[model samples]
Target: MSRKDRDHFNLLCDIGELAALVTGSHNIETFMDSAVRLVSRHLKADVCSIYLYDESAEELILRATIGLNPKAVGRIRMKPGEGLVGATFENLHPIRESAAGGNPLFKYFEEADEERFESFLAVPIQRGVQRIGVLVVQHETADYFSERDVMALKASASQLAGAVENARLLMDLYEATGTHPEVQAPASLQFIRGQSASEGIAQGPITFFKKSHVAFLSGDAHRNENFTVEDFHEAVRQTSRQLADLQSRLAERLPESASLIFTAHFMILKDPKFIDRIVHQIAEGVSPPEAVKNVARHYINVFASSSHAYIREKVSDMEDLAGRILKNLFRRGAEKQENEKGKIVVAAELYPSEILKMASEEVQGVILVKGGITSHVSILARSLKIPLVIADHPHLMHLPEETPVLLDANVGNIYIRPDQEILLQFAGQEAAGKIAAASPSTVCRITQTGDGTRVRLLANINLLSELSTAKELNAEGIGLYRTEFPFIIRPTFPSEEEQYLVYKHLFDEMADREVTIRTLDIAGDKALVYANATSGKNPDLGLRSIRFSLRNRPLFEQQLRAILRAGAEARHLRIMFPMISSLDEFRDARSVVDACVRDLKREDLPHHPGPSIGMMVEVPSVVEIMPALAREADFFSIGTNDFIQYTLAVDRTNEKVADYYRAYHPAVLRGLARVVRAAKTAGREIAVCGEMGHETAYIPFLLGIGIRILSVGPQFLPALRERIAGLTLAEAERHARLLLAEDTLAGALKVLETPTSG
Candidate 1:
């Protein structure tokens, strides 16, 4: 070979040697040192150092160095976008050139750290889209690193990432179990809240999460065994075989989505480039730990300092890979660990696959180390009503697996090492909550006040699937049936025939209960499938509900025809209009309803003899026109949630003002009182349907306001009914009057908590 080719050959040989050292050594620091030393020697650079990306800190941290001031070994760090390293990190690309020193992105510090490095190459180590770390190599001589060297280093860096990942995995395995004698039990428990989606009681031991438990364990000790060269070779062979076996098992179990991630892990464990580097370093008469640590440091540094965004993302995976490889090499006899279902999984955060691992019968509750109320996990938990907790105390990781833990999902509290008193008490409280939520709703007849005034308790229906919920809650009849859900999910407005089929089933299901069908009042933020109601920037204030129906008369007429035809077979059917802010909107809508009835008659369609027409009291303007609306309409359903938001000109979805979002605001109450009183005077039935109806705390207040019909989500009916069944009308009315008279809502709410017995 030519001299230059021979030198390149030697460089390749050196890299292989370093990889070998990595395979044999268990210590991360020693592996990195050996690798950096080789780079410095081969390049004849005054200072050759690798700066690794610290995933947790989101900064470049110096990992290993050669021919530099000893103080600079581990002290250097730079934020992304601050210097050459940062620029490389930010752009996820390599930066290396003779003129790189003069670039604005490169900031040179004039400290006495051995010698200044004018030549630098920073490449990002990545896995797929995620940036793991950056790899950096610097020299005192300008132009020392050419394009060819950069390419070679880039390739070398890829190999390095694999080594580092293996070492990290080994470290993780050691840290996970008591094999690392230094690790110990955590000091406390972490707790968080998740919606009680399913109503069931379960108690099981806490499984501590590694990320959550790390704070309790001191991870400074090396857990690798000391060994001779022959023993080390044998260990490497044994570990590689073991890794191959474990990988095969993992492949069989992982979902398709996670296959790529695991594949990367497998490749890292088997990468020849990584294996050779460590073995070479170990052959240089160095201790296995020292060799491993040195090579690991080098790989970690390069991985950390890498500028390629894709490559940078691979640093963690690389570290994990390297850790695993080391663990296999040194801890050959260590038992393989896997997530055991039928046991509580304590985790800082669970990926979707991890959640899927839970058999519905096995997992009772989920305790998260950190999550928010609006997080995806919590939202899913809400949809399922699974008890979950997030952001608890840090020591939750120390709890023993399969040990019974008292979990309070409401308050985000999990009692680890809970005393018998606390456990028994919490169990009793949980049981009561479940019992209260599941007890049968009684069928109560509407009674008059002391002076004999008739009260009507109607039902609110949103989802067609929840008709059964109304029956369980003992609703007198369907008072408010929203007809927008079908239009929202469908690609086009449901045809008249399609609409009829849906309405027909609902009418049939409520054969005994009176059914009130609202015409497509799909406006505001409510969208439709095939309608000209284009979305506005502000959907809440945009065209929807009654406005959309009125605008699209054809769609409205078709829907009306279907309702009339379906209503003909109903036990009791009524038509209601939503968002009738003024008498003009109400009268105009009523005229259309009249037109629909006239058309139905012309077509000889069967419909109720006289379906009562009603209007939804959701706007302040509606309250103003209540006297007129009450005179014309047969009944009124109070959409209190929207009424409060619109009256206050507040967007309930806006976080900044959401705290002020209250259903019981005096303005909302006043509007509701005005409409209900007007409807009462006209002898029209009024029902409260919205989020307010489902709140157990507001059941008494609603009853006090003479809102006999309560429309709520299916899941919330039990508690709401339980609250109502426990109260007398006289007591409810007295509390309602006091709540409305109060200046602040907080004081009014306190009135409801007076603890009246069932």
Candidate 2:
């Protein structure tokens, strides 16, 4: 073998041995010590150390080391972003220095006595986005570490990260249990990590949240086949009404986003395929509860196995729907128990309705065995300020009810049977109210650059309940009020009166400010089963947005009439059509609006003389013909989320290509620049209302590109305003010009990292 090939083979074998050592160990100290020894021996380094992130202290604590002061372990610490170690962790990337002592970021620890080391190499140990720790190796000789050495260390670090996290969690359990002599818990108190849906900390008794299981009736088919189709149909009707009631309650108690969950449940209950299968099962002489369970499991398995993450998440909604129906069919009721203040509710999965019903002053937090950050229940938890941790530990469901536990959703952790010190620490953290007060001040003020370039900051809202938050954050107006919400929440199409009520309410709330509402943008992927909308094979590229509305004229006219009537009730109303791929689509939608106005006039109804019309500039095709569409539309709203996705042909929801869906790609920046220039040439007002607008790093770029109106989620308004108020128009323009010259996303991102002023 060649020398280089032999070296590579030896490195792989060393990494394999290290991985085995780390994975087989359970003690934090022993695991960490072995890791450093393995790294030092394999790399032939003078010193090696591991630092675990202490979130509460906001510092990196040296956990274990070799070839340096052994006492430095558990004693040495560095604040995040303090030195080379901190910088490596903060950037989530590796850093190397041949002459470590010459670098300004290098810090000396007197006790460690490592000032003699002249070479440093460090890599972040991470599990997904969460930073577990940092791994470091150093040598007394300069230029001792090669690029290949860094690569080998990085590969070892990745394998060591999970083991490090598990060992730390095991240690925490031991300390909480007050077990001396370092005895590991029988089960190691597994901390099943998940995405943090809400941010808070709470400690209370864990109460398992479960629906009452239904007992299916059993008898000989020939002797007791007495239930009729009407009986099965009646059960369906009752379940529908119950779900509707829950929807109303959620809408009243939480945000419209939360209530949308029950809307999904309502759709599932009325799904033709699902209902037909259940009815068929009933006709085969199966009891109602048994049929519901069988059909639900079949759908759940099918959805759970789907390639799409969003589709797989729908399995939870299906399970919730089936359980609710079975309960209704069996006439089962929720368990009656005394309401205990500050209880931590645990469940296999929580539905939106269940979350809303559980919302009380007494309830402290929530723990779910299964849930996603995008789930409706998660949204409700955030809206209501409840701490929630979604963990899938096998023992979680089997835990005894009312068991004392600590739920730290801020870090996405749950501590079962926490000890006194841990409980006290959580109590102190809670008393500090740090997470609750994390949001900036609610003072209403106009945002402008240092040079006095006026910027209108608006809110993008999906529910009326969010308006109050927007108002508190001093949003200049409602820039993108998604109108598809009403359609998604109803079992059938919303009538003119029903749609009018919602629009009118929003108009009344934002009475003095401009409110731009985007029309229904639903497609096969987001279609309401009750709407009879076919699930096209390629939903994203198929019938959706303006195309769907154009084909369904009645649905289009009904919404337009309601919007116009609501505009009459409250001025400053604007209607925007989403996914306008062509000028013809915009013109067709405008004609429907014109017809609605004529009908309103013919009926002698009170209405505004005319409301401003706009089109969402999301598709690349629209950018190609923007000037032509600009002549007809009153204004333009750039939807960066979809624009980037379509421009790159990368599905943001597809994990395989999601990493390539870059919002700051050079192509996307050029597209935005072209749209802004087109709007300027046509003398049309333009605004941005997408996730990009909410990003602080993108703020300077957006402003630099001449986008004066920025719309974002209400929670982000404060931080965005602060960022905007710190920049000058000239600086932003200069930055924009520099960004336009970039040919890669990395180049564009690097421009953002530089100080905007300098």
Model 2: per-residue Cα lDDT over 1-758, one tens digit each: 34563353235233235434533343345657777887788788999999888654677978889988998887888987779999998987789999988889998889998988899999887643356689999999999998767766765675455456544433332233211233333455635565566778877887666422211222122223444666667667666655555545555754332343443454455345567778899888786666777887776676666543434655656765665565554443332223334788878775454565566324789887765553546655776667887775657766666767888899898888888888888788776786667856556488888788899999988668788888987899999987766665433455554566678778889999989989988763355544444557777787788888888786687688878977885668789999999887888899889989998787555677688999999999987898898899999999887898889997664535757888878989999999999998999999999778988888888898889999887888877877888899888988889999999878988997888752
Model 2 residue 372 distance off true place after TM-score fit, in angstroms: 7.7
Question: Where's the lowest-lDDT run of ten residues in candidate 2?
Answer: 213-222
Where does candidate 1 have its weakest 10-residue lDDT segment? 254-263
**Distance from true location, Cα of 3 in model 1, Å:** 99
Task: RMSD for all candidates, in order, please.
Answer: 20.9, 29.7
Model 2: per-residue Cα lDDT at residue 357 = 56
Candidate models: Cα lDDT each: 0.60, 0.72
Candidate 1 lDDT, tens digit per residue, 1-758? Answer: 24573344225333235435554444466666766676656556566566665555666766677766667655677887778777877887888856556877776654425335677777765432334456667776778886556644554454455455443333322222233433445544333334332233446665654332232122333434465555545545654554445434433432111112333344444454455666787787765545555665665566566554333444544554445445544554454533233445577675332343342223667777654443334434443345676644445555555666666666656665568788788778878988976876455455333334444556666555456656765667776776765454332344454466568778888898888877775543344423544667887788877887777676687688778877786767888888888888888888887888887676444666577788777888777677777778888888776788888898764545767877777777766777778888888888877767767777667777767776655556555545666677887787778878877777755765666545
Winner by lDDT:
2
Per model, state how many residue pairs clash.
115, 0
